[model samples]
Structure formats: structure tokens, C-alpha cells
Target chain A: MRNIRIAVSYDGTTYHGFQTQPIGNTVQDVLEHAIRMLTGEQTSVTASGRTDAGVHARRQVINFETSSPIPVNRWALALNSWLPGDIVVLQADEVAPSFHASYNARRKTYRYGIDTSKFGDVFERNYRLHYPMPLRLQEMKAALAHVVGKHDFTSFASRRSTKTSHVRTILDARMEESEGKLDIFLTGDGFLYNMVRIIVGTLFWVGEGKLSADDFKRILEARNRTAAGPTAVAHGLMLWDVEYDD
Target chain B: MRNIRIAVSYDGTTYHGFQTQPIGNTVQDVLEHAIRMLTGEQTSVTASGRTDAGVHARRQVINFETSSPIPVNRWALALNSWLPGDIVVLQADEVAPSFHASYNARRKTYRYGIDTSKFGDVFERNYRLHYPMPLRLQEMKAALAHVVGKHDFTSFASRRSTKTSHVRTILDARMEESEGKLDIFLTGDGFLYNMVRIIVGTLFWVGEGKLSADDFKRILEARNRTAAGPTAVAHGLMLWDVEYDD
Candidate 1:
């Protein structure tokens, strides 16, 4: 058996999520079915992480063991031909059997895009959040500073989570604003369910002057989901990139 | 009766174009129906020009005569509630009673967007053309010079046009390129059907070294539709804006 790794990008507006479900309209379901048809093997594919419904991904890594005779480099083109237009395998490679898409040591970067352009950009209507309200960039930055570091992220986690521990390390966090568009980028060792969206929602509150930077720190220390703002819209969030040791 | 002018924008990928048809799916058909539903009166809506199927518009001028008691300022908000998300009315104003959407226009600006970004952009999937070939920018600029002044543009027109005269003035023509993207902006007194798209297609051939600058000049003077390159795809073309001498 050979372990094959593939990098994929997808527009997730019409998809249920990255994980397989009973409904079978998710990105994972579509990709697995295409792989099954092409390689004639019914196998489970593991992803770097799962994204919610309506979320996008610029590059999501996945791995699976297959016994097919096809060359690893040609798997991308072959599978893309069978997959839908929204999901595309950007590249494929043969990796060591020890490499796991989810458990391997690495960091991930996510971005939440907000369209401040008045009347909004029509081309990005499905991929971004149209926020017409005024935002204080400086305040948002201050709030972001309090989020960088290793800490218990229970305040940023989803209420439905059943994790054994909520501790995680936030490597970097910053906001990029230009041309009436704001993009919040966060790099971390890992994220809890809905953590990035909840962080962005809290930053928006800071920009609106409703939540101060000092208050954000207190909320983080509280280690409770109810202590933070609402989770940002799912469509605004994107799994931008994943990094692994060479 | 009062003449109300509206500036509208739309993602026209799914519509049958800007003009009303017996098919009842055109932009005009949808707009007129929404007006009737909001103002309780059936009215004929006039547009500055017609757009082909799958073409978009950032700003299209439209006017209509109505007897409703609603103020013009409120029409945009009221009509937006009734229209689909793809179409939006940007602004509304009262024009002179003699004003016409199709006849009383001054100048119009159209743009053709090319996704020089390899593999195209996910968000702009429906708004741009994916042209991955290398382009000679200097040669394209030189070719655009031959198409700048007043000329009989019969070579760039489509066969479905009913206008008697093919003579038109090209007020301005230029190409804007940035960050693996190219945009061709053309401002003209008026245009024949499919004029901008054909001109773009012809310029692309010049960039590819298939046609020289001098050959483009002769094509312009030939006064024949077969003298030029094929019409570019409708998805890349957009009616950017319209200016009127008020």
C-alpha cells in the first residue's frame, strides 16, 4: 500500500462541509466517490482538518492509502476529470507511510474575508461577508494582539464541541485591509470547532467599540464559550494554507 | 407621468441579457415585473443599450415613465427588496420627461476582464475570462492605437445589428494590467453590437504575434465583419458605466 498526499482547493458555498455526512453532498464525499470510481477502491480519506458548511479552502491537504497502479503525479489530473468543477486537486505526491493528514505536526492558516466595499463586490458575493458598518482598524489590531499565544481557547470554541482539552497555541494573527476589504489571518498549531469564526466575530465587536482589548483578554481567561461574541458567518471563513516540516 | 432614471448593476451569467424578450427572463423583463409589483403599474423600461447573454454590467442606465405616487429616492430600496440577489439598483433619480434610456445617452464605458492569474480566480469564476497564454503587452498597446479614433467599425460588429450606419467614435481605449490580471477599458460615443468583444479578441491575436499592428489597421479599413478575429466570450465583457450630458 502507498500513501498518497494531495492538495485541493474548493469553493464550498454549495457544499455541506469537508467531512462526509449521511447526505453525501460534502467536499469529502464528492472527492472520495471520484477516487473510488477512478481507482476502483473504496477507501477512507483523511483531511488536515474539517471546515463548516459554506466555508472555502485555498489549499487543504488530504491523504489516503491506495493500491491502484496509476502514477502518483498523474492522480491530480485523473481525479480532477471526474470531480465537480467546485473541487479541484491542485497537486498530488507520494509521501512516507508515517505521514498523516490530521495528526502530523504542523500549523494551519485561516482567513476571514469581509467586503467593506459599499454595494459589495458581486464576484465575491458567495465567498465574503458584506459588512457595511464602520470598523476601527487600530482597535481590531489591539484585540488581535491579545489572541496570540498558547492558551485555553474555550472562549473561542463552539458550544457543540466534545474535545478532551481546549488548549492550543496561536502562532500569529493580523488583519489586512485594502480597497474596502478586510481580511483577518490567523496561524495556529490547531483550532477548536468554530474557533476562527468566533475570534473574528470578537474582533468585529472590538472594531465597533463594543468590546475593548482589555475585555477580550478577560473573556479568553474566562474559558467559556458564552463569554465571547457570536461566531462569524461561515461563508466568510476560508482554510487558506497548511504548513508541514520538510 | 414622471421619468425616473436608475443606475443598476448585475451578475448576468444566468440572465438572457438586458433587453425584454417574449421569454420573460431578460434583465428588462425582470426589472419591469418588479416595478409593476412594487408600484402597481405596468410600465416599459428603456435601457441605454442591449447586452448579450452571460454578459455582466457594473452600471447600466435605465429609465421608465411611471404614474406611481412613490418618490424616486425610495424606489431603489423598495425595488431591491423585490429583486433577486444577483441584480441590484444602485441609485434612482428623476430625469426630464423627454429623457430616454436608449436614445439620449452621451458616452458609455465598457470593460473586458482577463484572468491572467493562472487557473483563474475562484471568486471571479463567472466574471472573467481564463486566458493563460503569454501576452505581449507592448504589441497589444500598439494595436489598440489603430482603433482609437472615429472610424467605420463594420469589421467589429455582429450580424444581428439593425443600425443603418456603422460609423462610431472611440473616445478612449487603454489596457490596465496588474498582479496577473488584465483589464481593457473602452469609452465610446456608441458601439455596434458585439463591438467591444471583437476588438478585445483582435487585440489578443496581436499579443500572440498572429496579427501585426498594420494588419489591424487594414482590418479596420476593410469595412467587413470577416476581416477581424472572432468575438470574445460574453462573460468577460461588462458595461462599466454610462455618462449622460444632463
Candidate 2:
């Protein structure tokens, strides 16, 4: 059997999330079913990470083993034909047998989009967070600088996470605004559950003048979830890119 | 009664179209309802144009008359608070008593988005047209030249149109491709019914090698509905902007 790596993209609005659940539809369930129909092999596929419902992914990595004789490029077309319109396999290729989708990931980048206009956009409701108030960009930028390096991000992690390590390395964090839209981009070695959302919410507080930059720093040192702001909505977050090293 | 002009935006996925329809919800119905809720006034609103079902608008011009003493900026906030999340009043101001949303327009711009990747985007399913094959940009550009002049666009209009004059002047027509996405932008004095969609369809056919640039020009001269390509899906089109001369 050959191990195949597939790069996928999905609009997660219709999905329960990236991982399969017993109650609702998932990106994984539909993808696995499509693979089964194409190759007639009941193979379990693993992704680089799990995204919550209403979140989107531009380039999500997944890997599975199959014995089918189909060419690598055909995997994308074959699987996509059976999959629904909301999920699609962007590219597929053969990989080393030792490669693992989850274990081999080097870094992940996520983008949180906010529409700061007084009025929201009708078409982008599913993809962006609408915040009517004018955000203080300079204050938000100062607060972001405090979270750019490695730290124990317990303040930003969700309480439901089972991971023992609360520390992670944050490579970069920045905010960009254009045409009345504000986007916060974060790149890290790995993220804890709801880490991105919580960080965004905390930054929003800074933008709103409710929390100062020093307060953000204090929250980081607290190492407690209660110190951070509320988790932002799921729809505003997107897994923009996942990096893997050879 | 004071004449009020408002800039509106709507996600057209759930509505039958922009105009009021007996069959399904519309942008007008929602906007009128929101206005009635805000001022307790029976108001009649007129739009610059009636957009078809599943077609979005970024800045649609609308007008109404009311005696309410509310401030201009408050109109947006009040109407938005009562309107559904899919529709929003971006701005509101008092216009001259004789100002008409439909008759006083100087120009309008429409944008059509196409995702040409082999895999479709699930998140943009309601906002873009997904074509799996690679498109020829040069051919599409060549065809666009034929559409950038004054002409009777009966060939590009639907037979169901009620407008008496099919002649319209196209100021600009261009195609842009970025990040595997293709966008067609058209600016004109006005458009015939389904004119923009049919033009896009014909350009798509030209890009796909099914038609030539000369063929597109021939169709424009035919002045018959059968000469043009099929009307592209409404979901892929957006009323991007409307311009008025003071």
C-alpha cells in the first residue's frame, strides 16, 4: 500500500467540523466516504488538525493509505466527483510511507477576519465577523506585540482541551486592515484548543479600549483562562495554511 | 415628506430577487419591513435596479420618503438593527425631493467571480461560479473588447425584459485573475436584463475555446437572443457599485 498526501480546501459552514462526529456531517466523513467509493477501500484518513464548525480552511493537509492503481492526480478528481460542493480535494500526491499528516506538521497559520464597518455585508456573513465599532488599530498592534514570542498560553486555550502542555511557540502575529475589513493573522508551531479565537477576542478588547496592552501581558502571565477575553465566533476563523518540512 | 436615500447591501442567496415577489422573500420586503419596524411608518422604497435571485449587491441605492425626525446616520443603525443579518443599510441621507433611485443613476458596475480551480471552494459556493478547467485569459480579454462600446444589447438580454430601449453604453469591461480566482468587472451607463450574465457566459465560452472573439462580435451584431450564450448563474454576479452625478 502506498501512502498518499492530499491537500484539501473546504467551506466549513455546512460542516459540523473537520473531524467526524456521530451527530452531524463532517469534512472527514464525507471525504472518507468519497475515497471509499473511488478506491473501494475502507481507509481511515487523518488530518493535520481539527477545526470547529463554521470555520474555513484554505489548505488543509490529510493523508491516507490505499492500494488502488489510480494515478496520484486522479485521486483529486475521483474523490471530488463523489464529494459534496462544500468540500473539495485541491491536490493529491504520493508521499513517503513514514509521512504522517498530524505528526509531521511544522507550523500552522490561521487568519481571523473582521468586518469593522458599521453595516455588515450580506454575502460575507458566513465567512467574516461583523464588528460595528471603530477598532483602535494602534492599540491592537501594541497588544499583539506582547503575544509574538513563545509563552504558556493557558490564558488563551479552551478549558475543554486535554493537552498537558500549555506552552507553545508563537512565530508571528499581526493585524492588517483594508477596505473597512480587519484581518488578524497568527502563525505558531502549534495551537491549543480555541487559542486563536481567544487571542482574537483579547485583541478585540484592546481595540475597544476595554483592555490595555499591559493588561494583555498580564493575562498571558496569569496562565488562566479566566484572565483572557471571550472566544470569538467560529465563522471568523480560517486555517489559512499548514507548513510541513521534509 | 423628506426624501431619503440609502446605500444598501444584501446577501441574495435566500431571496427570490431584489424586488418584492409573492412567492419568496426579497431584499425589498426585508428592507421595507425593517423600516416599518423602526419608524412605525408605512413606507414605500424604490431601488436603482431589481437584482435577480441568488445575486448579491454591495452598494444598492434605495430611496423612500418619511416624516420621521431621526438623524441621517441613525437611519443605518436603526434599520440594520431591525433588518435580517443578510441585509444591511450601509448609509442613509436626505436627497433632493425629486431624486429617484432608478432614474437618476449615472452608471453602475457589476462583478462576476469564477473559481477556476479543479476543486471548488465550499465557503464561496453561494458567491462564485466554480469551473474545474483552466481558462484562457487572453481569449477572454479578446472577447471583452467586443463588449466595451455603445450597442443595442438585445442579443445579450433575456426575452422576458420589459425595457423598451435595448441600447446601452458600456464604459469599461475587464477581467482579472488572482489566487486561482477570476473576476469579470463591467461598468456601464446601464444594462439590459440578463445582459451582464449573458456577456459573461459568452466570454466563458470564448475562454473555453467553444467560441472566438470574432464570434462574440458577431453575436453582438445579431441583435437576437439566440445569438448570445446562456445566462450565467445569478449567484456568481454582484451589483458592485452604482454611481450618480450630484
Candidate 3:
């Protein structure tokens, strides 16, 4: 069997999430079903990370083993024919047998989009968060600085998480505005459960003048979920990219 | 009664077209209904131009006479609250008594979006046309030059058009690529029925090596609908802006 690596992009509005779930539709369930139909083999695919329901992905990475004779490049075309319109396989490539999508050492990037216009965009309602109130960009930037380094993000993590480690390295965190959209881009070695969403919520509070820049530092030092801001909605969040070491 | 000019935006997937149609829902129908809901008066709203079925609008200008007590700016907010999620009123202001939405327009701009990636973007399917093959940008540029400037666009127009004159000034026509999307922007004093779609189709033919640059000139000079390329799908077209000379 040969291991294949695939890059995917999906509109997560109709999906329950990236992982397979017992009750609803998921990106993994549909993808695996498409692979099974293409290769006539029941394949279990693993992704680099699992995103929440209504969270989109631009370049999600996944890997699986298959014994089918179909060429690697043809995987996208074959699988796409069976997959729904909301999910797409961008590219497929052969990888070393030892390669694992989740264990590969590298960084990941996520972006949360916010529409700061007084009026919401009807066309982009599914993809962006509409915040009618004006945001203070400078204050949001000040709060972002506190979360730019490696630290224990227990305060930002979801209370339901079972992960043992609360420590993660954040490579960059920046807020950019263009064309009536405010985009928060964060690159990190990894993230705790709901880390990015919690961070965005905290920054939004700072932008709204509800919290100061120093409040972010206090929350991080507190290491308690109650000290952090409310988590933002999932639709505004997107897994922009997943990078794996060559 | 005051003549109010309103700027509107809509996702046209559910509408038949901009004009009031007998069978399917139209932008005019929705707007008129929303206006009636805002005020007890039954009013007639005239748009700057009629877009084809399934065509979207980022900014469509319309003028209507109303005796309602709602302020001009408040009309937008009020109508938006009553309208469906697919349609929105961006701005509203009172216009001169002599102003006409259709007759007073000096120029209009339309943008056609094409997704040229091998794999289509799931999020933008409703807003863009997916073309999997690689496009030759240079060839497209060569063909675009043939359409710029004042000329008779009879060949690019629909055979069913009732316009008396085919001469229209094309202020600008250009193609731009951004983030895996190709945008074809056209600015003109006016357009014939399906003129922009036919132009895009002809340019796509040139990009695909189906038609030569020299052949485009001959096709334009033919002054026959059969001489031009097929009309592109309507969903990818957008009425971007309308410029009125004071």
C-alpha cells in the first residue's frame, strides 16, 4: 500500500466538523466515502487537525494508505466527482510510507474574518462575522502583542478539552483590515482547544473598549477559563493552512 | 413625494432578474415588496438597468417616489430590516426631482469573476464561474484591446435586443488576477443585452486559443450575433457600480 498526501479546501457551513461524528455530516466522513467509492476500499483518512463545525479550511492536509492503481494526481478529480459541492480536493501527491499527517513537525496558520461595516454584507454572511460597532484597531493590536510568544494558554482553552498540554508556541498574531473586512491571522506551532476563537474574542473585547491591553496579560497569567473572554462563533474562523516538514 | 435614490446589493441566486418578471422572483419584486412593507403606499421602483436572471449586484442604483415620512437614510435601514437576507440596501439619499435612475446614468461598471484554479472554490461557487483549464493571459489581453474605445457592439449584443443604436463608448476593459480568482472589469456608458457576457465569452475563447486576436476584430466588424462567441453564464456577472453625471 502507498501513502498519499492530499490538500483540501472546503466550505464548512453544512459540515458538522472535520472529524467523523456519529450523528451529523463531517468533512472526513464525506471524504472517506469518496475515497472508498474511487478505490473500492474502505479507507480511514486522518487529517492534520480537526476544526469545529462551520469552520472553513483553505489548505487542509490529510493522509491515507491505499492499494488502488489510480495515479496520485487523479485522486482529486476522482474524489471530487463523488464529493458534494461544498468540499474539494485541491491536490493529491504520493508521500513516504512513514509520513503521518498529524505527527509531521511544522507550523499551522488560521485566520478569523470579521466584517466591521455598519451594515452586514448579505453575500458574505456565511463566511464572516458582522460586527456593526466600530473597532479600535490600535487597542486590538496592543492585546495581540501579549499572545505572540510561547506560553500556557489554559485560560484560552475550552473547558471540555482533554488534552494534557496547555503550552503552545505562537509564531505570529496580527490584525489586518482591507475592503471593509477585518482579518486576524495567527500562525502557531499548535493550538489548544478553541484557542484561536478565544483569543479573537478577547481581542474583540479589547477593540470594543470592554477590556484593556493589560487585561489580556492578566488573563494569560491567570490560567483560568473564567478570566478569558467569550469564544467567538465558528463561522468566522478558518483553517488557512497546515504546513508539514519536508 | 420625494425622489429617493437607493444603493442596493443582492445575491441573485433566487431571483429571476432585476426587472419584474411574470414567472419568477425578481430584484424589483423583492424591493417593491420591502418598500410596501416599510410604507403603506404602493410604489414603483425603477432601476438603472436590468440584469439577467441569476446575475448578482454589489451596487445597484434605483429611484422611487414616496410620500412616506421616513427620512431618506432611514428608508435604507427600514427597508433592510424588512427585506430578505439575500437583498440589502447599502445607502439611500434624496435625488433631484428631475433625476431618473435609468435615463440619467452616464456610465456603468460590471465585473465578471472566473475561478481559474484546477479545483473550484466551494465558498465562491455562487459568485464565480469555474474554468479548470489554464488561461493564456497574454492572449486575453490582446483580444481585450480590440474591444476598448467607442465602437458598434452589434456582434456582441443579443439578437433579441430592441435598442435603436449599437454605438457605445467603452471607457475601460481589463482583466486582473487575485487570490486564485480572475476578474474581468468593464466600464461603459451603457451595454446592450448580454453584451458583457458575450464579450467575456469571446475573451475566454481567445484565452483558450480557440480564436486569434485578428479574428476578434473581424468578428466585431461582422455586426451579427452569430459571429460573436456564446454568452457566458449569468451567475458570475455583477453590476458593480453606476456613475451619474451631475
Compared with the true structure, all predictions reach lDDT values of: 0.90, 0.90, 0.91
Instruction: List model 1 lDDT by residue over A50-73, tens digit each.
Output: 999999999999999999989987
Error of 1 at B55 (Å): 0.6
Q: lDDT tens digits, residues A106-222, model 2?
A: 999999999876677677777899997877899899999898888999999999989999999999999998986889999999999999999999999999999999999999999
Question: What fraction of the genuine interface contacts, i.e. the true contacts, does candidate 2 reproduce?
Answer: 1.00
Question: Which numbered prediction scores highest in DockQ against the true structure?
Answer: 2
TM-score of 3: 0.96
Worst 10 residues of 1 chain A by lDDT: A117-126
Q: Which TM-score value belongs to model 1?
A: 0.94
Stronger candidate by DockQ (2 vs 3): 2
Q: Name model 2 segments beyond 4 Å from true.
A: none
Single out the weakest 10-residue window by summed lDDT for candidate 2 chain A: A116-125
- For A28-123, candidate 3 gives per-residue lDDT tens digits of 999999999888999999899999999999889999999998988788899999998889999999999999888894899999999877678878
User: Each prediction's DockQ?
Assistant: 0.42, 0.76, 0.71
Candidates 1 and 3 compared by lDDT, better number: 3
